[model samples]
Target: MRILGCSDICSIFTRKKKINTASESQLARCLSTLDLTALGIGSTLGVGVYVLAGSVSRDTAGPAVIISFAIAALASMIAGLCYAEFGARVPRAGSAYVYSYVTMGEFVAFLIGWTLILEYVIGSASVVRGLSTYVDALFNNSMRNAFKSAAHIDISHLSSYPDFFAFGVTILFSAALAFGAKESSLANNIFTVANLSVVIFVVIAGAFKADPANWNTHPPCTDEDCKQGKGGFAPYGIAGIISGAATCFYGFIGFDCVATTGEEARNPQKSIPIAIVASLSVVFLAYFGVSVVLTMVLPYYEQNPDAPFPHLFDKIGWEWAKWLVSLGAICGLCSSLLGAMYPLPRVIYAMASDGLIFKWMGKVNPRFHTPLMGTLSAGLLTGVLAAIFELNQLVNMMSIGTLLAYSIVAACVLILRYEESEVSEKKNDNTALTASSVLKLIINANKTTHATKLSARLVTSLVFLYFILCVCFTSLVARFTHDINNLEMWIIVPMIFLIISLVTVLFCIYLQPVSGTRLTFSVPLVPFLPALSILINVYLMMMLDIMTWVRFGVWMIVGLLIYFFYGVRHSDISVRKISMKSIRLDGRKNVDSPKFT
Candidate 1:
């Protein structure tokens, strides 16, 4: 950080200790591999799998729905490898938010943090909305009457509630986070395991009923009036597959969440990375296998793309099958959303400690030892978004923001590596005598310093590549794809909105003051990743129509209004900046090494 003097560096160090004040004793390092793996699966493989199968089959991949799932799986695998490494290395809260802070830049950190508002918070809302609809269906189907008068409510003021039970649950999760890390992890463990069983059961039993004929031809495409067997393979064609991938990509976003727990997880160096890859692998298998069975058991067009999977078992007369699926989804969402709740506050706390956000955001509950302010804000925003936005809109917006953040994080790793290479070599010149020995030393040092950098960049790249397919596929639907009912328009708008939001956020981050930021963990390579991230991002935007762009503009305006009116003066970062200057002469501020048993 050439921008800061030695005193500034000292200030940064002092602030770091304050962000995570919990002792390793306060937080449980007890998350087993199974526990971690379960969190990964629970979060990654939620309701998206149930709904996406029908959407892809009916609109995008057709029988090639298998291939679309396969493509997403591959993309996730590539990104997973990087995430694993970072999770292992950083093992800190704030996943990409922290990754950007350490390896990328502050603006990058802020952008990721801000955009994640779309991911976890918006995502939680989306899930709640989905769960609400499903619950409503179950109640109505079972009761055969209006249960509104049943005097039962999941959340009060049903129509006014954010999404579904999510806001309600988020309030609880935020409280969970504030009180302690151990309690949250334990809660995460229970829900994750329950959901894992659900996916495994869905996959195993589902496989038994597959009919091969479903793969041979399409019954019909409701998206268009088609002759029998005419709209076969690539159901929606390459274009539709791409579009569907964009939407379906929502399922894969879960794997990335594993990184968000980098700081909290025990042995994060080992667990975080493993959790990511394991989760992706597990979800891929389940999603692809389940999608195949879904098509086989029922005609792709026959399935309601909007509400397919839960109804899958009920249609077959499997008693409580729909309920089981719903239960699994609810549990899975609870655990993942809880995990999401943990990272953002730690990040805001970290930023505050660094003078990025409000000082209070960085302040720990002395009694609870958690970031009280950060977690609360995240929960509040999540509730509001869920209450207002519909499921499809929230999910679409989330996809764009996630893709944008992942893509940039990937590029930053590469950029940092390239810049530091020359300096590294110039310093290490002729360190050893023998040619082999010298070569070995240089190579070893480069590997030592650049390992994290390389892995991060590659992961970022693969993630970006996956989203590219999603963008292109979705855009094709806009151009050559035809739809009578306007479902395609939903995908188009999100893509466009994503581009606008990404660009605006990037500009905002870039325009920030250069004083307080530092590039401590830069890996290497820059322009290439950024350029590609930008290109693919822009292409995604153009692929959609004006309507999508307009909605995205609204989101940006809202974000700006919040930042200028509230976020600016109240930012923790700014507080940290002031705190940096007000240290004790001896330079110690009640340091504590928090640990979870």
Candidate 2:
């Protein structure tokens, strides 16, 4: 193998590959836009509505959890547009992985595929663990003890007990996937519809049961002691709403699952975008409506973590509604698990087929024509993880993976668009002049366009601006609220950042471009929207605790080791290097052409 150097690293990061949109013989294109939309709804609506609604309200945001959901939805919408553009352009499996490969390169692609495992596999495991909690509520603790005793597994001495139901659900869904895509879609559709019905019922029921007294925006809390203890609309103040938005980001995680279904989607370019947007909009409204009524139905303090909806019904003396709500949660969770697990195998299959993993992992079952081996492997691994570990840390780790991937995808969109604009300008110049004269024409423009120069500088300034502003805001808030000796030092950083930010802003204003290339189906405001998306994702990622960052770093290290030792040796790029090799970004290869290196 050839040793890589600085140029090679730059090439890997900067060079783009043609998208692989060839129809695979193994996977069927049977999913419609509605089917894709249902998937988005199914994957996202389960745990957020059933579990997180009350938990976040009780612990963090109180009645302002509605704002949290709204904030998260806005961030997801911004990221969703980027996903839509790529999905439309590529129409391939491996969502961000394929996008990065075509626009970023193989190494970045590998990292994205690795990060996606956290989003899909570990994410599914987290969902399964959540499912078990609801299952325990439905069956009572008796069922859990029965399974433990029957299996001769005694973890009574441990801090937390194992969840066998979670393990069983993972295996069950793996079997469903092995059966085929058509079957899985049918089940998903049925369960998703049921989940929707449940959400609607909760909203309607809670509306009728709502008490005006429960809608207090302020409830006699001015100090830290009352803010930390009480459960009113603004009990924890503005900070709680912001923190809740970061936490509620998990609710918006599922809409991107539609991107992973490109290989199987009919008219993927249209379907993926529609499904992502439509599903996110639907879920946001549902979550917002349910949250509004939930707080009004019961004080945030009295909400149950596992069965908040049912508890609301029971509170109103409607035993029938309580059971009905529980049943809906079960269906919702089952569909969510199905949606979560569906993408993992396909992602592994995409990577394996590219020779980044064991080749056998790419094999499709003859009868089902799906990635059976990968499905089973993903299932067993998630089952074990869900069974053995507590999911609080795992869920936190999952969110970090999500934010990291979103940031990369946003960057990819900006880079790819910029490259396209360059290509357009080159073509326009060539068309207007003869090839010999084109070289002498001198183009006369700056090497970097004004927009490009400003964007680069603005992004850099924003990063510093973000940290500094955050520090200033926190320190200023702390100075008034708590005991802090070095308030002046804390204030200084923000002041410096503010000055730098103002200078950069003025510079950008002065250097605005006269005209730029426009993208078809592109994100509005080009660099600004994509840049903001990245900044927001990074901010939320920073809000995650230190241990989550540690876990994420460890995961990245493992991915790097696998890539260096296994992927680099077996990758298709490596094999092509031994013969004639040249990658064309224009979707056609000229192997006889000279290599860039």
Candidate 3:
């Protein structure tokens, strides 16, 4: 029991990686703000712009999908700010993984890195699967038909036939990444430029066919006939808009890819924040413009869900434009594929270098200045996933991992803001928590450094606890909304507890002094903005189905096993600490004894 309760075991998990040691990266630093912005845009502006706008407007938000995009964009921007601040401060390869390691601990960092690998792998596979499907549709489903005829084998949750095309595309791009950062980034830039041009063309061309009457059209139906109510600009109402915003939120996911390239950037502090904001701005404009044009060019109900752009051009007697749009769609998907795959190797490298995973994965190719082996490994794994699995099976898994990562990054920003420094984790002095002591601590928080640090740490922990409870409370309400009348006591008690906790957290945060540590760029509004980001992320996560949670749990278990069995023993920090301790003991023994002359 004592062995199980050993402090050494507990301390090992909470040990943080020092940022100063990771400041200089082995990877080549060649990316500019433009290149990074291109990465973000290319990675983010995929099939969503071409398909999501039309589907969401037609089925969910009506013309209000415009508002849906705006709402989702706002949430994404808030999360992006948190990423920007961390990217400027830490400027490491692993997006959330490195950030969490520096601020949280090794255990949390490993879990985040594990989740990130899941996100990128699934994200890449989904992109390529979409690409294969799009191409098959363009070719009249010949490829799918051929595969179906040759080797159709459908499992319950897998593809009906192997997606060889998707596999080939994934491997090809992975090889491209292995060539070098600059080369891969150049290709991404070209594809991104082409993708943007297509977006501009769509907006311009569709604007000519826009009709204001479409936005105001009211279908003749009673409340019983139309659950969403009579058709208009907001045919689906506020609930529908919020739901659509949840769906649209996926469109803004790839922006964090910008943060993953910190090590590759020439001036990460300046360029990373700039790239994150710029790419998000560009991606939002593209989505918003397309949604507006899509709703305006035709009635929301009339829009096609699968291939809206090509069909729109066809409906309007522009057959040539359909082919052009199809070509653009392929380019966009290719760019998205590259963007999704780009981060996986870098994240693996970061984790591997920290001795959390296989150290061989961290090796940078001297000639290419890239993680060649890891790149190939990731590409092969993603390719196999794309080749064997259906897109539906892979897509849902991506969201849970991404939302969790985003939520953690937001939480990290909040914690880091109140921290005195990166490595300041000393235990606070034991003090009684009486009313007068609390009042005095609050009052003198800014006057005394000790008070400031102590209060900041105490309140930060409280805020985190409150945040967990808030998520639980929100999930409970959502789960039992129908039974609220009968469960009023259950609901009311928790709600009251949550309110009190929120008020206390806010008050403490306000009274506590912020860290004096400066950064070139930092998240403003501190606890409020980050707190909102956490709430939004939690809400969105709650929106995911139960099966997603199950899958996430399974992945987490696998990660924990690896961390305990391998990472705990082989960690570089643990090894260094042991060596330092041994050195101190040896010196102490020598000093204690008399030396013979």
**Evaluated with TM-score, which candidate comes out highest?**
3
- In candidate 3, residue 88 scores what lDDT? 94
Candidate 3 achieves a global lDDT of: 0.86
Q: How well does candidate 2 match the true structure, expressed as C-alpha RMSD?
A: 6.9
Clashing pairs in 2: none
The CA lDDT at 524 in model 2 is 71
In the range 1-597, model 3's lDDT, one tens digit per residue, is 345456876687778988873557788999999999999999999989999999998889999999999999999999999999999998889999999998889988999999999999999999999899988987899999999999897687888898899989999999999989899999999988888998899999999999989999876567678744469999988878988999999999998999999889999999999999998999999999998998899888888998899879888999888877878888899999999999999999999888899889889999998999999999999999998887685577898889889888998888877776444434443566789777766555425443245666666676678578768866976687556647578677877787787767766665666677879999988778888888888888887788888988998899888888888878899778879999999999999988899
lDDT of 1 by residue, 121-225 (tens): 667666655555666565664421333344343553344332435456567777877778667767877887787788778878777777777666656336476
* Model 2 lDDT per residue over 1-597, tens place: 678899976765444456545645468888999999999899888867877788878778888899999998998999999998888887877888888888667888988899998778778987888778776766677756776666644454331556777888899999898778888989999999998998898888778888867867344555665644455566767878877887788788877788988888878878998898999999999889888888888888777866687787778888898777877888888888988898888889889988887888878888887889988998999998888776776778778777778887887776655442332334333334556543322232333343333333334444345445544444444344332334466656665665576445433433433235443466776666766687677667766678887888898899888877888768876766634434443235455566896
Better of 1 and 3 by lDDT: 3
lDDT, candidates in the order shown: 0.60, 0.75, 0.86
List RMSD in Å for every model shown.
11.0, 6.9, 2.9
Off by over 4 Å in 1: 1-32, 141-167, 218-224, 227-233, 314-320, 388-392, 421-597
- Model 2 is weakest, by summed lDDT over 10 consecutive residues, at 438-447
